[model samples]
Target: MSQPDNPLYKTETASYRERWIGFIHGLQDRICAALEDLDGQALFRTDEWEREHGGGGKTRVLSGGRVFEKGGVNSSVVWGKVTDTMRTQLKIDGKNWFACGLSLVIHPVNPYVPTTHGNWRYFELYDDSGNVSDRWMGGGADLTPYYLFREDARHFHRSFKDAMDAFDTGWYPKYKQWCDEYFANKHRGNEMRGIGGVFYDHLRPADSADADRLFSFQQANGNAFLPAYLPIVEKRAVMPYGERELEWQEIRRGRYVEFNLIHDRGTLFGLKTNGRTESILMSLPPRARWEYDYQPEEGSPEAVLLDACQHPKDWVK
Candidate 1:
């Protein structure tokens, strides 16, 4: 809910930003590479966009792939004088800020392969003299299944919990709960967006040594993305699905759309900051549906997914 409070080591502020930009861009490439390899038939289209203010980002979108229907891997390195809206939202008195991050969303073609999303970001606020007064890191990964798969959910949750437990034994459970709460669609009966994963923020460094520790933690989570989601996708991508399954997927995607537009802070931030609208909305599915009085039959797989959402599980346990 809150942001990070650690200050960037000031001795090499420019160098740090450079390194972060390099890492994020590199992450974007590596993830795209993996997706391209997995997809085989489709390739990602890259768009390098410049912000109106002072920075730019590379957006890579893959569609109609062998496995995935649509996916986006994007990285942005931007900085500017904090706007009044940002000042109000972030509640910061700082004059300027810098942000760099990589975000990704993968929607597999088959309903068997659950949709997945993850992001990792670094941010800083600075004074007039260009000294970093505050800095932080935030992100997490989660899975949304049209057909609930217990093993898949457990593996996804366990993978992130391992990444967090390596840093703090308490972080896994704490942030696992945070994710469930944070990604909910409150207007839709408090249903979760997905099977929960560890979500953390305001990871402030207590000392200089702690900064490196947090960075490594972020890298660990980011690197673990493939392992967490790929196996499930590989198993399910080629499984046969009929129109009924596809219909449920689209219906579930309606809820995904609802959560993003109605509650996602990322969408709000991007729109408010005048960030590229296309790239921000690339998270949406290629197709979705909303039907009046739609209801899944009891004891059906679709109903099972809804039941899971209604009553979240402790996947790792």
Candidate 2:
């Protein structure tokens, strides 16, 4: 696919904060619509909820589909007084804070089709007089396939690389390395969560013009998600799978659950800030299994996946 253009750059009259909020909400709608069309048999059920402290969000989920077994595309805009918890856990030194973002995870029923995840968020910290003190942007898209498909992994990584290269030629390499490192089960010998794509955090802009550019960059990545993933889903969603593939998928999902609960800062931040319990944990797969001393046979497809996890590949290059 071609590199995505940043049409969202400098096109809005709204303030930077408002522009991000509007973009995430609109993105949620667009993504849900496209996913429904892809699933063919399932629809998203939305829950519009408010946080007791400050802002609210819309959580849309789809379950029991012909394609996807369970998935969630959530948008949240939450703000409140910077509490002791925030200071201690998130290391913010502001009196007040505001945050908005869209986070999503799709778990396909067919093991041949990889599960995908993407998130794009913006945050601000305010001082005593309610002036913006500090702010930054964070997010990226990654793929987690139970079975290795070289072309599918390459397509997934290349699409996001194209998006980042439009912004900066250096970013794809930097963020791709960060993703391989960040989404790993460190306790399990640094095994990656998937054949990594791209990940970044704490992208502080130097000025307003730079901030607009960053916002546009974020939009570029967000817009790239469907293109990166949908084609792979379409290609593999029809492939046959049996009990063996299903078993391996669940076993790998168990590691996915491990990374989120134990190592993910997003999960830790949400819980520490009193974010919604249900929405915070929506990234978990519908089913997972842990078997003691379980290992795939030598030279098997499952073993190939395990090997890739242990040694992250430069898929795009």
* Clash-forming residue pairs, model 2: none
The reply for model 2, stretches above 4 Å from the true place, is 1-14
| Tens-digit per-residue lDDT, 224-251, candidate 2 | 9998999999999999989999999999
Determine which window of 10 residues in candidate 2 has minimal summed lDDT: 1-10
lDDT of 1: 0.85
How many residue pairs collide in each prediction? 2, 0
238: Cα error in model 1, Å: 1.8
Q: Write down the TM-score of every candidate.
A: 0.94, 0.95
RMSD of each: 4.0, 6.2
Evaluate model 2: give its lDDT.
0.90
Model 1 lDDT per residue over 1-317, tens place: 01232223332466766777777777788889998998898999999998877678999999998899999999998777778998898576587777889989899999999999999988878876667788888888889999998988988988888887788898888888899998899998899977777677777777668877888888889988888988898888888989999999999999999999989887888887888999999999999999997999999999999998888789987
